[model samples]
Target chain A: MSAHATTEHAYVPGEIAKPNTAWIWKTFWVLVIITAIEFAIAFALTSPDWRTFRNSIFIVLTILKAFFIVGEFMHLKHEVKSLIWTVLIPTSLLVWLVVALVTEGSFIGETLSHMFSS
Target chain B: MAHSTTLESSSTPIYADAPRTGTWDGGNEPFKASYGKLMMWFFLLSDAFTFGAFLTAYGMIRHKHGVFVGTADKFFFSTAHWPIPEKVFNGFPGLHGMDLPLAFVALMTMILIFSSVTMVLAVEAGHRMDKADVQKWLLWTILFGAMFLSSQAWEWSHFIGGSEKGLLMADGSVMHGANLATNEYGPPLFADLFFFITGFHGTHVFSGVCLLVWCFIATTNGTFEKRGHYEMVEKIGLYWHFVDLVWVFVFTFFYLV
Candidate 1:
């Protein structure tokens, strides 16, 4: 504890911070636009095939929105690259795992029904 | 009942940060993250896994049920495809008996996403060292967050109060509200999972609001200004944004999909 120096009297600059009010507004608008598309798709679609297509679109848009919120709103984009990957790679694995498990689970359900129902 | 007794003068292994060797060697963050930020990121990752498990289980069960069979005439009252999330969460506030179909939750999602924007604005204000603006944005963020929690409370009440008397279950039995043994909505697991996942996410939002309250107070009290930086606000912003991100997934799985 004694080894650490105090930062109470640390340097201060007159510029404060690089105020990018424009960028923040852009991010807010992009999120709204994506959500607008999601609502539109939700109300407009009807058939099962189109339902599947709409589901894919919703998932893609969601991932896109998640990307923006995590990268920009959370400021992970400004952080060092290594730190960003440290969070992203494991999360990708998580998504893959969910997909694999759900697929296997559905197959098992089908197999079990075939075995017993007959 | 939840509290545990503290041990007398504990040290070494239980208290140690680890051996401090190799890639994670002594004092250096090679990752360039502060202790607080690194810990929050790891916590969020673990939490992501927990939510992942819940949603995956939901997918498996709902898929097993196949396409919805029941009539869509009565809609929310009559049972349909258990996998059909849009049918399940079709209630709207104030205007009861109207089949708005995901409209209420759509509003909830917008409320949450807007709060995330406010939180980001607060962080931006913090960056510029504008305490007044930071306080203003934090206040708005907290208000929106609380508004969301109240909306969730209303939704829960409507869910628990369910279809006046009761709805018909898969086995033709009538079940009311929800419990471990019975569920009016498809399988018993349906109601159970809804309560658990949304309940868990709701708990996090509640805590995030509390955190915002603290940050708001600290900012107003001139703590960040005195400290010469608003790193604390940034840390909490990460947390706030994470809560919003998880909700997006929950909304997709529970409502849209």
Candidate 2:
């Protein structure tokens, strides 16, 4: 209501007063580049020694992609620090959950292997 | 004396200095955010946890199966019996005779990512208040989303129905498609996990598509124009991107890993 009088003469129906599209394009390109890297990692590394390394790289790349989507596309990147932390801080614990569960699950596999072989 | 005082207060008008009974006091905007967008953010945060738990369970079980070595059986699924993600996901669409591996899924991912890009453009248009532009970009986004959903359905059917030769596992057993019990892939657990994770993600894609359609109608039909704001476009854009974001992880953990 306060804005109604100030912009009465300049008001336009279909556009922001000033538009910026560069960031959207930049984000799109970044996602493409990361996905390309993912494909490269998928087929290029074939050795068992490389398996763990490759998987870690993929996880990192996946996180990077998520960052762009959340930060740029979702516009959280521009939001205030409180809004950003409200999101990122607690989700960090979820990452811990990933680490803990994988470790325990590996132990279960090892136990099963021992039981079956014996 | 207290009853008499209350009667006096009512008669004299306790709130006489202030106006009463109109609209809400709305509440604080700590981050200069709107109520709707903040709620959406919180909703997305809770959703992240749900997907996180599912992926964690996946990580746990697959780790137990052991890390993948080159051959299908040793780490993946040998007669030794552990599942390899790549082996199970190796099917290519239409080109049945050859194993194109992750090619088809990669294509699906591209479609989804591209759809996300289009959605961003639509929101951009909305920002400009360009109704025609918003409609055009939104239609494209909806198209891509629909394509993705249809392709997913085809992929699901092919997996469930399987191929004529069936999957020849490292165990020397031939299995067809997947079931709750077992499939040629690896263990019954592998089948269960695949169904659960992908199915959950697919449902989100389906919902996003529906949201896209609604947005398209609202954009073309002057809904936002009437309100004098395009925040709805921005809100749905948040959701569309989230769907794509989740798929990025799914593609990594389920297919790539």
Task: Write model 1 residue lDDT over B1-257, tens digit each, in one string.
Answer: 11122332445333353334334335455666667777888898898888888888887777665565444444453333463666667788879877687889989988998899888888877767778889999999999999999999998988787765587666777777666556566666778888999999999999999999999999999998877777788889989999999999988878887
Return model 1's CA RMSD, one decimal. Answer: 7.5
Which lDDT tens digits does candidate 1 get at residues A40-82?
8877875565767988999999999999999898878878898
TM-score of each: 0.84, 0.86
Candidates' C-alpha lDDT: 0.78, 0.79
Every candidate's DockQ is 0.42, 0.53
The DockQ-based CAPRI class assigned to model 2 is medium
Estimate the overall C-alpha local distance difference test score of candidate 1. 0.78
- lDDT of model 2 at position B25: 25
Candidate 1 pairs with clashing backbones: B68-B81
Each candidate structure's count of clashing pairs: 1, 9
TM-score of 1: 0.84
Q: What is residue B148's positional error in candidate 2, in angstroms?
A: 0.8
Segments in model 2 whose C-alpha atoms lie over 4 Å from true places: A1-19, A116-118, B1-27, B67-79, B167-174
